[model samples]
Target: MDGLNWNDVRDLARRVAQGEPLLLTAVTRSILLRVAPQVGIAPGNAERALQSGATAEELLQEVSRRISNGSRRLSRTLADVERCRVAGDIDGARQLLNDVLAVEVVPHYQDILRANLAALDDES
Candidate 1:
């Protein structure tokens, strides 16, 4: 992660989304390996996809779709957590986050969920 920047992968996604014919160069591959896990994609899966002769466009599109889906799920789950909190069901909110942590692959979202759980713990 030292030499990796999330923005590089994001820019690549943006470029690909805008129809840029970006090549799947070594640099691109490296960026994907680092950023994929943060977006809920296993680095190994991305590596396998890259090695499977898929075009850069296809891989990038898949990554973009996954990122979108992960974001949406996180939003919905957080909203549910909020609802539980508003209803004075702290245990339910904690359970919701724990359930997400059990399956969520995105590191950023995991951090958020963990932080929310910690906050709930503090309240108790």
Candidate 2:
């Protein structure tokens, strides 16, 4: 149920859309919770899909659209960070980075954020 709430859904969608990890444990659990039973659709098959690299669209309806919007938010956040940095506002950049980091991201993106924060540190 981790990815069911609006904020968590959006965050999960962002991570999934970014292709961070399709085989997330939380995702599989979320899919299991959100997926309604279909006529003649095997539970095993659905479980398989959840285990496999199924996209949010594949797992649940309207999730893909939510994921798309979440992707846009992610992109806009990144752009905002760049814009603030470009404007030479180190505090602003740090604030933006902190806000982004407050959300859940896969480990690699976390590294990129650490790097960003480090670069910000080097700026001031």
Candidate 3:
């Protein structure tokens, strides 16, 4: 809840999307304070509590809790993709994976993503 900045929020969002955890340390909170405003996430009085300290798991959990209220198709898609992967439905998972490459993702992530997609293609 600290005053999150745009960069911080973007970084956090990117990390979250990439399945990485974000630590809620003082540094992380400060960055969030700077980035949140840019993303329209209001920095409420809860900043003090966040500043106290939090783990990446805690931060992710908090973000999930807050975002869960909003009806976003992306969230549903991500969940579906995860479920498909878990269920060994490579084709289903590949179809869901294609949606992410439309955005500019990091090269390393992109490579891994491509590899995953290729694995699915190989199965066919």
Candidate 4:
């Protein structure tokens, strides 16, 4: 995390989406502000944490944890959506994927998610 920043986060997220996980270490306030809402954390709290002199490593750890958790949730949701689709529940799957798309997501991850959503739309 010592050498990490928002760019690292973006890259890591992208790599992860592509089945890779380049290590990351940055988390600037502006980046925090953008990522906070997606991860259910308030921007003010993220700012406060940085203002309190939290190291980039510590903040990166927290951010990485949140991203990991979000990724897991998204995976589960995708599974659910697949089940729904298999059961002839097109609307259910579509809604589930839509909700997933609305969550705070890493930039690269967001692209994959949006693509999945679009594919779902085509299927429907």
Candidate 5:
């Protein structure tokens, strides 16, 4: 989250767009591993795809989709969390944060979820 590098993402996309073969060179592998999680695609999932002969184009498309959907999902879920808290349903709010944290792989989103959960704890 702290050292987010959009240049890496753009480079990957450029390679894919140019129809470059996705050879698992050390540099390529590092980019794939690092950018995957930052964009909300789980690292394990990306690794599996890469190992299973997925093209860079295919992976890029999937990352794009995940980034879009993940943004909406986080926003909606956070809204629900706020609703629960406003309704005096602390347990419900905690549960919502916990649920997000369970599947959230992005460090920034995980931090947000954890912070919300901690706020609920403070209120208690």
Candidate 6:
């Protein structure tokens, strides 16, 4: 929650605006809880979205697409994080790679993610 970023809030707002059910992973949920007060959206709203059975993956994809298109590196980072590991844990060398992506712009981030994924494939 302490590390909650503005991108998370923007994504939550977009989901609310789209009438998309909130599919919050635990980390995402924590971010939302911290941001709810600032956005004027209640924590209950996110809970309700979860209760309504929204697919978090779908919502995350939507957010990623929007962010990617908008040239926001943070969105790309989130997507990379989501795809790179399950349940949000990017350990070992992957974690180091993600840290680099986290500060990049979208265009650069996309290239980096693609390269990283390819490297992973090469390893496999």
Which residue pairs come into collision in candidate 5?
A: none
Give the worst 10-residue stretch by lDDT in candidate 3.
Answer: 64-73
Q: Please report the candidate that would top lDDT against the real structure.
A: 1
For candidate 2, write residues 1-124 as lDDT tens digits.
2232345545655676787665557745555445322212245655665655544336543444434544565577678889998998889989987887676233334456678889889888
* Candidate 5 per-residue C-alpha lDDT over 1-124 given as tens digits, one digit per residue, 9 for 90 to 100: 4377657666666676688766767787777777788877777877877774466557766665555566677898899998998999999999988987888666677888888889999997
Flag regions of model 3 displaced more than 4 Å.
Answer: 1-82, 86-88
Residue 77 lDDT (model 1): 90
Q: Kindly provide the TM-score of model 4 when superposed on the true structure, using C-alpha atoms.
A: 0.54
Per-residue C-alpha lDDT of model 4 across residues 1-124, encoded as one tens digit per residue? 1322446556544555576533333534556556655555566666666654334335545676777766787789889988998999988888887787787455545666677778888987
lDDT scores for all predictions?
A: 0.77, 0.57, 0.54, 0.63, 0.75, 0.53
Measured against the true structure, the TM-scores of the candidates, in listed sequence, are: 0.72, 0.43, 0.33, 0.54, 0.63, 0.28
Question: What is the descending TM-score order?
Answer: 1, 5, 4, 2, 3, 6
lDDT of 6 by residue, 7-114 (tens): 865766577668865555676766645544333334565455444335444434444554445455545555665575655444544674657556544344447566
Better of 3 and 5 by lDDT: 5
- Candidate 4 deviation (Cα RMSD): 8.2
Stretches > 4 Å off in candidate 1: 2-7, 17-19, 40-45, 52-58
lDDT of 3 at 79: 73
Q: Regarding lDDT, does 2 or 3 come out ahead? A: 2
The per-prediction tally of clashing pairs is 0, 0, 13, 4, 0, 0
- Ranking the candidates on lDDT from highest down gives 1, 5, 4, 2, 3, 6
Q: Provide the global lDDT of candidate 2 against the true structure.
A: 0.57
